[model samples]
Target: MLFAAGCLAILLGITHSILGEVLVFKRLRENSIIPNLTGHKFNLRQIRILWVSWHLVTLFGWALGILLFLLADVNNAPATLITQLKQVIAIAMCGGATLVLLGTKAKHPGWIVLLSIAILVWFT
Candidate 1:
């Protein structure tokens, strides 16, 4: 179950990044949906920052999935370290779920997978 959660997380990250880029970011750019973070002179910079920030979430998720994969295999790993990793991953997953749920007003399906991963990590 834990390993499956890890695989799900990695898959989610990959799909999120790719689909978001193609469906969300590309449309935003093409439709000139750039927000005015700074003055009008730095519109491209703001868009770039938003683009990077979006992908950073994916990168963090990938890292968590990698950690989960490692944890699933390390039979002789330290108990304290394992506990700490589990705690961190659960908290992170829950936090991410909350953010996505609230930010998208429960419209985004990403929250479901994130919350599921959190539950798996918590019980595993």
Candidate 2:
């Protein structure tokens, strides 16, 4: 169940990224959807639901990965390498979340933040 949940979360990030890429972004920026954050009053409250959802997914995935790594058999060089790789991936995800929370996007850091958290959790 937990493994499935982790996969679902990674899928969610992909979905969200695609949707944001297509739907949320302004046509002018081409790939970037961010608006004028410097002048406008960014509404954190409006986007809170998405932010939290992503956060939970990330946290759970990360925690699970860490737990599994600690418990998994690492007798072989490959197994140890895989565990190390997952930890690195998890750390990257955490880094992504940090970027978002640090105000990467005032409008839709939702997808970015959530996906970051999820990916980090899964690999970690």
Candidate 3:
């Protein structure tokens, strides 16, 4: 279950990035819908920053998933390390879920998978 949760987290990260690119950013780009943070050329800087920030979430999730996967495969790991991993992963997942839920008013599906991952890690 822990491995599966890790896999799901990875999958979710990939899906989130792809969907955001195709469904959100593409349309925004096509329509020139990015908000202007500065008066002139500096507005492009805002777009670039926003783009990087958007993808950073995906990268962070990927890192967490990779850590979970690697830890799941560890043999004879110390109980303290396992306990710490469980706590960290579970807390991160729950925090991410809460953020998504509140940030998007539950419109985004990421919260569901995130909460599911947290539950799996908790039970494992």
Candidate 4:
């Protein structure tokens, strides 16, 4: 479970960075896909900054997930603390996924897979 979660976290981190920094930001800067899809005028600099911030947040989330997995594997903490940590991770991941799916209507497969893995790891 820990291994699976760790690997998924790393994969998601990479995917998020690529999608946000390269794909989405590029489109926004070029005034191409995003303006058409969103139907909103965006200042290139502001949009770029926003996406960069989002990318950083995603990377931070992945780092936290990895840290949690390592802490669980080491078994160096009290049982209660570990249990609490797992619950927090589960809630955070699931809630984030839910927001992405419903709020944004995102078609990204990576998010769906991340949500599935998060639920599975939480249970197992």
Clashing pairs in 3: none
For candidate 4, what is the lDDT?
0.60
* Top TM-score prediction, candidate number: 1
Give the per-residue lDDT digits (tens) of candidate 4, residues 23-94: 566655344433223316655444534553465467557857666566657555677666666766676567
Best by lDDT: 1
Arrange candidates by lDDT, descending.
Answer: 1, 3, 4, 2
Clashes of 1: 0
lDDT (10s digit) by residue, model 2, range 58-112: 5555555544444453454777657765665566556556535543344446547
After the best TM-score superposition of candidate 2, give how far the Cα of residue 117 lies from its true spot, in angstroms.
13
Which whole-number lDDT from 0 to 100 does residue 88 have in model 2?
53
Off by over 4 Å in 2: 26-90, 97-124
Candidate 1 global CA lDDT score: 0.71
TM for candidate 4 is 0.44
TM-score, one value per model: 0.50, 0.37, 0.49, 0.44
Off by over 4 Å in 1: 27-42, 74-76, 79-124
